[model samples]
Target: MSIQNSIETKVKEGFLALYNTEIPTVEFQATRKEFEGDITVVVFPLLRYKKGNPVQIGEDLGKYIVENVTEITNYNVVKGFLNLVIDDSFYTNFFNAIYSDATYGFVSPKADEKAVMVEYSSPNTNKPLHLGHVRNNLLGYSVAEIIKAAGKKVYKTQIINDRGIHICKSMLAWEKFAPNGSDGQKETPENTGLKGDKLVGNYYVKFDQEYKKEIAQLIAEGKTEDEAKKEAPLFVEAQQMLLKWEAGDAEVVALWKEMNSWVYKGFEVTYKSMGVDFDTLYYESNTYLLGKDVVAQGLEKGVFYKKEDGSVWCDLTEDGLDEKIVLRSDGTAVYMTQDIGTAIQRVKDYADVGGMVYTVGNEQDYHFQVLFLILKKLGFDWAKQLHHLSYGMVDLPSGKMKSREGTVVDADDLMDEMTATAKEISEELGKLDGYSDKEKNELYETIGLGALKYFILKVDPKKRILFDPKSSVDFQGNTGPFIQYTYARIQSIIRKADFDYSQPLTIELHEKEKELLKQLELYPETVQQAAANYSPAIIANYTYDLVKEFNSFYQNVHILGEQDLNKKVFRVQLSKKVAETIKSAFLLLGIQVPERM
Candidate 1:
């Protein structure tokens, strides 16, 4: 049993024996820094069972704990808090047990545990992934890793929004504006020497620009702006194309396949650059009509109602939400319909998956709420396990981004800029020595991407982020590069310790060493907590705290310079373990730690 568990049991036993009454449970917390203890037990709650002064009760319990608990060397009572100072041997033994464990804090999935499916980066094929998608991808990927570390089978997946009017807009723009060559073929990613997604995205913007001009022209001819928008020639053609493609028009379907193929290739490049991958894939083209039959069954079961106009709706008014449309009046599937069908299809594909997490932005908060509710109303037992990982938008100092205007920070471009910034900063610091150009470039990438992922993951998902690329790559404070640099520093130390340091020794611990051990001990619980909350921010902040504690220990203790062999070996072992834990925690956050920086 852990020392804390033993202390709790003894405290309960001591209370029952002394007060002649039993307390149901015990409350424990990390002892305050101002107090001289490792753990604090609140004595105020004990008064409910037996009325007495909190300070006297604390003193009595402190005395009983020290007398009964061998690992607890001393105790102090400050009003309602009973602070217990544990013996150094407990920490020494704990360190010894976990010293050589490379995967110390990670747990393995049990045989019978149900799997979790995490959906992220469900980007539309019309554009390349942007800064907003970066946050979504990072959060989703990190959460999946944390859940896996916390002992659950995890599947990372995404559903591509590969159909609809938005995609048609790009295709129509390409057909209308694409330049022909001597061979009589229009521009392609190959001919244009551009990424497929970027090439397609340029046309999406082109469609918007031309549509706006047409709207202006119609308004000049005395039509209302609303009417002009609907009457715009480019938009009308795009809509017609969507209909034709839906009806299996060969030409339009061929164009969609070719364009989407290009976009898929480009998407794969960006996803690889960002270091994220999916276990399974779904496309809107395939899943768009999925929920139609289910909607029919729901109508029969009275879970939904059809309007006189032939539209299908779910009446959620009694549940405090307005009626939501599952199918359009023209019998076309809505996004909700596709989502419903796709969710059911996923369960069919993976029977072991008991739950799913949709990593979508907060703009779709109402949409997901309605979707989950309707699914539950449709009587899927697994619907209870569904979660929407809604997160706030990521904005830059320059202001908000618009994809149609071509102003959004492209994900590939943003990553390149981060790498450049890292290169610039590292050169200014002039730390590179005896390193080839290739090694330096790789290190810069590690620092840059690590900085980007860490800065975003460290923030709570519910809060909006104002990301500044420059600040995120800094080598000080609670940043990713700072932690990476510390890891590298430990590596330098490990390399210097040429002597054998593997032997376990029982010695009186330094104050800094004990504090570091306490931080190290929190890693396993922190991973579980991060998984429970579906937030990488928990693991990120915990890692920062651990690094800070290790730094304090390094500054105050002598390792390689120590004359005593036992002390030197123990400190080196402690430093190595701390580095391993940092790497493990950063792995959960999808950040890489460099061996040298």
Candidate 2:
């Protein structure tokens, strides 16, 4: 049993024996730094069970606990808090127990446990992934890793928005404007020598620009803005193209497939560059018509109602939300309709999936709320297990991004920029004296990517972030490079330890060493907490704290300079364990630690 668990048990037993009162629960906190203790017992809560001065009750309980618990040597009562000082042997034994555990904080999934499906990076095929998608992918990927570490089977998935009017707009623009190749064929990724996604994305922007120009021309000729927008030739043609693609018009469908294939190829490169992956994929083209039949069934069962214009909707006014449209008046499916079908299809595909997490931005908070309610109304048992990992938008220091204007920070470009920044900073610091150019380049990428992922993941998901790349790469304070540097320092220590240090030795601990061990002990619980809350920030902050504690120990104590061989061996062992723990924690955050930085 953990020392905290033992203390709780003994505290309850001590309370019952002394006051003849049975306290149902015990509340504990980290002992205050000013206090000489490792753990603190809040004695104020027990006042309700047995009325008395809190200080007196604390003193009595502390005395009882120290006498009964072997690990706890002494205690002090200040106000209602009982600070218990634990023996050094407790920490030493704890270190010995976990020293060899390579996967110390991770738990394996049980075969019978239900799997969780996490959906992220649901990007439109019209544009390359941007800064916003970067945040979404990082958050989703890290959360999935943390959940898997906490002992759950997790499936990473995404639903690509590969259809609809937006897609057709790009298609129409490309057809009308793309320059022909020398072979007399229209521009393609191969002929143009541009990334398929970027090439297609340029067309999406072109469509918007032309559509706006048409709208302006019609307005100049005396038409209302809304009428001009609806009547614009580019938009009208895009809408017709959508209908053609839906109806399986051979030429349009072929064009759609070819263009979408290009976008998919481009997306593969970006996802690889960003270091995120999916276990399964869903395309909107395949799933857009999914929930229509379910809507019909829901209508018959009174779960939904049809309007006078033949539109289907789920009236959620009674459930504290506005009425939500499921199908359009012309019997076409809306986004909500497609979502309902796609969700059911996923469960059919993965029978063991008991729950799903949708990693969407906070803008769709209400949409998810309505979707979840409608699913519950339709009576799916797994509906209750649905979660929306709603997060705030990511804004750049310059301003917000606009994809249609082609002003967004592209994911690939952002990653490349980060790598460049790392290279510049590393060179300026002059830290790579003996490294070859190839090794230096690889290390720069690792530091660059690590800095990017860490800076984004360290923030609370619901809070907006204004990311600055230079600040994230600084090798000081809460940044990733600082932690990475510490890990590299430990590796240097391990390399220099010529003598064997694998043997675990029982020694009287330094204050810094005991604190480091305490920090290490929190890793398992930290993983569980991060998974439960669906927040990577918890794990990130915990890792930063652990690094800070290790730094203090390194500064105040001598590892190799110690006269006592036992002290040197124990310190080396402690330092290696701390590094191992740092790497493990960082892996959950989707950040890599370089052995040398």
Candidate 3:
């Protein structure tokens, strides 16, 4: 058991013996720095059960603990707080126990545990991913890794928004504006040497431009703004195209498949570059009409009602939400309908999936709320397990991004920019003196990506981010490269040790060494807390704290240079463990560390 748990058990025993009163729990916090103790037990909460001076009560408990708890060597009472100083041997034993564990803080999933499906990077095929998508992917991937480390099985998945008016807009624009006819002569990713998604996305922008021109011309011909917008020739043609695509017209389907294939290839390159992946992919083209059958079942069960216009909706006003439409008036499935069907289809495919996490933007918070509620109302037992990982917008310094306007910070471009920044900064610092050009470039990529991922992941997910690329790549402060550099320093120490430093030893602990060990002890608990909160920020900050502690120890204490062989070996061991913990924490955040940076 943890020291805190043991203390709680003993504290309850003390309460029963002293005042003949039963206390169910105890509250403890890290002792303040000014206080001469390692842990503090708050005596304020016990006043309700045992009516007396809190200071006296704390003194009595401290005496009881020092007498009964062997690990606690000494104690002091400050007001209502009882502070206990633990023996150094306890920390030494704890360090020894975890020293050889390569995966010390991770727990493996048990056989009976149900799997969690984490859906992230659910991007549209019309455009490449951008900065906002970067945050989503990082957050989702990190959360999934953390959950796995906390002993739960996890499956990464995404739903591709491959079919919609937005996609058709791109296709229509490409067909009308490409240099040649819509055949082999058309502008392809190969001939143009442009990414497939970018090429397709350019056309999406072109469609908007042309559509706007048509709308203006119609308005000039004495039509109202709304009338012109609806009556524009381009708009009508796009609607017709959608209808034909839904009917599975061979020619339209062929074109859609070809263009979407280009987009899929483009997305593969970007996802690879960003270091994110999914175990399964659900396409809207296949799942768009899915929830129609479910809607019919809901109608029979009186969970939904059909209006005179033939639109289907679930009445949720009684449950404090407005009625939500599941199907259109023409019997076509809406987005909500498709979402319900897709969620159910996932369970059918993966029987052991007990819950799903939707890593979507906060704009759709209400949508998820309704979706989960409707599922529960429809009698899905697993609906209660659903969660919406709602996150705020990520903006660049200039401002927000608009995909159709092509003003967004493209994911590929952002990553390339980070790499270039790292290269510049590393060269300026002259840290890569002996490295070959190839090795230097690879290290730059690692540092660059690490900075980008760490800067974004270290913030609370719900908080908006104003990302500055240059600021994120800094070599100092609470940044990814900073922590990574510390790890590299420890690696250098390991390499420079000429003699064996692996033997177990007992030595007097320096204050810095003790502080570092205290920080290391929190790693497992940090991982568990990060998983429970579904927040990568917790792990990211914990790693920063550990790095800070190790740096302090490194600066103030001697490792290999120490004359005492036992002290030198123990310090080396402590440094190695700290480096291992940093690597493990960074792994959960999807950040990489360089051995020499």
Candidate 4:
């Protein structure tokens, strides 16, 4: 239950004395800054049921609420909107209730019973994870956490792209150039040798460069351009190698397994550093082929058709989407085919009532549009439950990150650079100068990751982001370190206070304390909205706002060492509640706050 629920209950009791039946949920919304009220009851949604004009019904409800509801000490009607001023004593009681309990700022009664499946971080084995993947992972992970906090059972899953022509290109490069991790310059801490994805990414580059060279030479020898590119043995070999691996050739399978494992090892470290973990892992190597059978079934059932070239396709033209191919002419599954199969597999494997996939890219909006349409056409009613949590791209100061130009922000490298940069900044601020190597490492990583996640998640999901690396890395303004610092400062104050805040509240708080508490009071509602809309940025924005408000309150007001005992006690309790609330919000966003950061 929430404060609004209690207010509504009292309003209903008054209305019941005057009417016959029950009132619906109250129209509770936060008031505008100009309105000298705590909440604005937009009773427009209820006027129809009252058998009167909007203004008349608004007046009746306003009187009914104020006369019976103790929470609203005074209220008035303005432009048919009921603006209610909550009693200052309500703040005193709110603190009293919160001081003895930890779960202060959330709704208790949960809605419905279905599960939410959140899919994210669907990276490929052929290349290193980039800044784009990092944003995707953070948003996806944070969304899952927020949904869970909203009292929904959420399943976090990752679909790894472990097979296909891309995977084989790297394998082929490794086979010819540096077989079995013995390139005579294998990766070591001191050496510049790359990890699995980077190593494989290098080969992907090599394959492209070498293939282009081979084509140029062939065209020079009088072969046609198309023929020169087509007959290039490197691509042909790579394709053949994929076919061989798909056919379960022992050596090819072994090499594929070896490469993907190395990639996993590298990815795991990054995931841990970012403080995210998946509940389930689905490999495309396994699911992509399975999708082929689903496509075949769909074709047989008239949900799809065979093109002139014998490729499997679905006509989504009715939905303004183009005809999409599910399988190649060679009877191999394409991206769509594999995805259809994976959807069915997850539904069966997890027994999930529904799913919410967070891919976090604007480019694939068309792809998911096709994906969900195809699933519905296949007669899976649960297809309606599928969602594409598409987020915008992370552009740099120059422009969009282009991989071929070698300007893409590699995830592992970005983490390293941010951590080092964080350490440098911390040292300059004298925040981590006397810290030991391990403590410095801890502070650097916590603050670095917090900065990265906040910068990426601060903007609304649909808006394209321009990340000026210089401007985003700063800790002085609306950054992650600022929030963490607020928490640290609160903790510092609490430690120095003579009174214990975990005890029951015994006094009325200050104006700033009451203000911070009011914001904290809406955490549950904020979380529920984020989960309902499938947007983690909402929670990110809320957490940052909460931190900012608390920080402002801390800077202006002295909590510890106050002259008045009541003021001192009140400040200490307020600081304690803010710290607890901040920590909880940070955890919901998959961010960790250093005890001292």
Q: Residue 468, candidate 1: how far off, in angstroms? A: 0.5
Which candidate, 2 or 3, has the higher lDDT? 2
Please state the error at residue 82 of candidate 3 in Å. Answer: 1.1
lDDT of 1 by residue, 1-597 (tens): 678779889989998899888888898898999989999998878889989899998888889989999899999988899999999999999999988788888888999998999999999999999999999999999999999999999999999999999999999999999997445689888877789999999999999999999999999999999999999888889999999998999999999999999999999999999999999999888898899999999999999999999999999999999999989999988889989999999999999998999999999999999999998999998899899998999999999999999999999999999999999999999999988999999999999999999999999998899999999999999999999999999999999999999899899899999999989888888898999999999999999999999899989989899999999999999999999999999988888899998
RMSD, one per candidate, in order: 1.8, 1.6, 1.7, 3.5
For residues 1-597, what per-residue lDDT tens digits would candidate 2 score against the true structure?
789889999989998899898988999999988889999999989999999999999999999998899999999998999999999999999999999988899999999999999999999999899999999999999999999999999999999999889999999999999999666789898887889999999999999999999999999999999999999999989999988988899999999999999999999999988888999999888898899999999999899999999999899998899999999999989889989999999999999999999999999999999999999999999999999998998887899889999899999999999999999999999989889999999899999999999999999999999999989989999989899999999999999999999888899999999999999999999999999999999999999999999999999999999889999999999999999999999988888888886
In model 2, the worst 10-residue window by lDDT is: 181-190
Cα lDDT of model 3 by residue, 1-597, tens digit: 677878899899999998899997899998999999888999999998999999999999999999999999999999999999989888898888889999899999999999999999999988888899999999999999999999999999999998888988999999899875345588999878889998998998899999999999999999999999999988888888889998889998999999999999999999888888889989988898899999999999999999999999999999889999999999888889999999999999999999999999999999999999989988998899999998999988798788888888889999999999999998899978889989999999999999999999999999999899999999799999999999999999999988887777656688888889889988888999998888999999999999999988999988888988889889889999999999999999998899998
Full-model lDDT, candidate 2: 0.93
Per-candidate TM-score against the hidden true structure? 0.97, 0.97, 0.97, 0.88
Off by over 4 Å in 1: 12-25, 45-50, 180-184
Over 18-130, each residue of candidate 4 has an lDDT whose tens digit, in order, gives 55557777777776767777778776766555665666666676788777777777777777677878777787877777775676555443456567788999888877788
lDDT of each: 0.93, 0.93, 0.92, 0.77
Cα distance off (Å), candidate 1, residue 578: 0.4
TM-score of 4: 0.88
Give the lDDT of residue 318 in candidate 4. Answer: 83
Q: Name the TM-score of candidate 2.
A: 0.97
